[model samples]
Target: MSITDKNLGSKAIQWQAHQNSNSEVPENTMAAMNYAWNLGGIPEIDIRQTADGIIIGIHDATPKRTLSVPEADQDKLISELTFDQIQQWDAGVKFGEQFRNEKVPSLKQILAGLSEHSDRQLYLDFKQVDLEALAALIQEYGVARQIIFAHNNHENCKTVKRLVPEVRTMLWIPARFPETAVETFTHIRQTGFDSLNMVQLHLPDAEEKQSWRYKLQKTFIQEALQYLGEAGMELEVLPYKFDQEDLFELLDMGIRRYAVDEPSVFVELLNRYFN
Candidate 1:
């Protein structure tokens, strides 16, 4: 479970493509995922479950804007709709050109596709209650060791670990409030988390007219890394934007894991330095 002990360190960038839709690159679709794999970057996808227990790839709890559920019916939660009903809504039309005609995919479909390609790793973000079932599916596919489950809820992490102990888990801390970084890390550790999923903004504030905050953040990162190293856990940092300098700084600190929206760009940078 230690950073050094775990085989989770990868110089490859973890790319989270947006779920396949019209305007943005439909993330979590077979096409987008394959596109990422072909670029030699790991694919990070989001998952939610239908009321009937079928797991689907999506980021939002409601199918409102993404799927164009009518304003009157937009309040329906994913958990309240059956898989068939959920699939009836077009998850791709809203985005227009970028996604064109892609469709939302199921968890089983994504896993099967991943199984065919062995060169890439999967970063599965569980955004629903059926995570227990998803965990079972992952184990059934023998991909527990190849996928990392990211969840904001501590209990979800515990559930994944208990159901699939061999699989790695990262605690996803929301960075909406910048002041809670330290407290979040503490909670992660207390929850027996194996890794940290923090945002770039959570880094320490800089002094006026100086990059001192950057330096201070770097020092704090090293300390946290060391602490996690000693405790047999890993640290995965996700910057707010695709900044190469930030990635390089973290890499220089001996942190090899990262999540980025632009996988192609980050992977190119990583290959330049590490490959």
Candidate 2:
């Protein structure tokens, strides 16, 4: 099915709030997701399972970046820690004084919030988690239709689809070792991934002066639109950083979905220029 068939957003084009609009709130926390939900953007979150098999919303394997972990525990992975142990660290204090006591949230917490808002949609970026447990939890919450299962791993995406066909799946390509749009489309088709709902393309860092090979040019966008369009899969772009020119160019090329750190800014630009 095309993205248009999904209830992700009312707009034909959608802006996915990366890391739950981290520019406004702490990354991968409920606060960030709430902010993104209020802005009518899909809240993209990274999910990992703890040692006890509890799924939590966190990006890194370690809590060092967004959580207040002790120096001694800095190198520890979330998979090695129990849920109770991992939740002790403050998730928001490092971001600002206003967000001092925010605790690490679980996948259940995120899903509970999504269940409240029928219009809300979530982009679940798969990390280290049990797909069966995740799928079961989503089913239990009756949020199977409200979340997008996304991962760089094609097998995971396919597995989730097999587990819950009602849930939409998105496969994201990493920026490292970039592939041509035709090559990407061909691979997706050959591998049977073209049957999925969406395929996300990574836009290289706009300000990067060095990595010319990683840059996604206008021709690449056009080719992606053509080939992916024929394959019946929607293509979404996630940039390393927000760039207005690049975004506008993509809009002109008929690419509508984007995962961005700045959701409010992207919406404003969309309204001013394309709306």
Candidate 3:
């Protein structure tokens, strides 16, 4: 199958409910994943291994900020904590005053809950764990085809390829990178990545800086279109917030994939524009 056929399915909406202030949704919780799945959007979650070798759904290494772990005693690495000790801390209580009662979730529980929706896609962001385990888990669930591994670490991407060659992988770019699209693409190709994932804000830099943004504006959506046309690489643009004009411009430029936090707004935009 073609790369796009393997990577792109329906228009994707990423529910970062783990960071939501009002939802009281714990990061990587079954409740959070279920909420995203129920919204008829794709569920994206961050994964990290606890000290005990159990893969749990958390974004940070320490439980201090998001859990009830004492500040003085929160120095334990995730890889060193057992699941039972990890579960003892309340992740929800520290999730701002709004969501003061959320619970931490295990990756297995989330996957088991998500297994019912065979058609939906999942974007797994590995924070601090071996990609091999993630590959094994995906393979175990027979959902390798429906998941995408995104990471900034090239080694992790390589590891994923070593473990699951058929699984799609994207190189994630931080907002501060100072490379042009050509330079970026060249780097990605050198790293043996299948695609590029970038924030929408990164596209608008001056020529002195990375000119991806200027290029997109000058050619409209044709900038990325031309990139894909020339290099045959998939593009996944992540927009921080829903901006109708920006979304329209991206759609006009031939970008079919987007990463968004608000599914309801994205679905509305999709229905009005693409549907």
lDDT of 2 by residue, 153-250 (tens): 77898899999888999988765545554466568767756438898888776446653323766566677667667777778988766556656666
RMSD of 2: 4.2
Q: Which residue pairs collide in model 1, if any?
A: 1-232, 2-232, 18-27, 19-26, 19-27, 20-26, 20-27, 22-95, 22-96, 23-95
TM-score of each: 0.79, 0.88, 0.76
In TM-score terms, candidate 3 sits at 0.76
The model with the greater TM-score, 1 or 3, is 1
lDDT of 3 by residue, 104-143 (tens): 7777776675566677667777788766777788777777
In candidate 1 the C-alpha lDDT for residue 153 amounts to 71
The candidate maximizing lDDT is 2
- Can you tell me which runs of candidate 2 are displaced by over 4 Å? 1-11, 180-184, 192-195, 206-214
**What is the C-alpha local distance difference test score of each model?**
0.64, 0.79, 0.60
lDDT assessment of candidate 1: 0.64
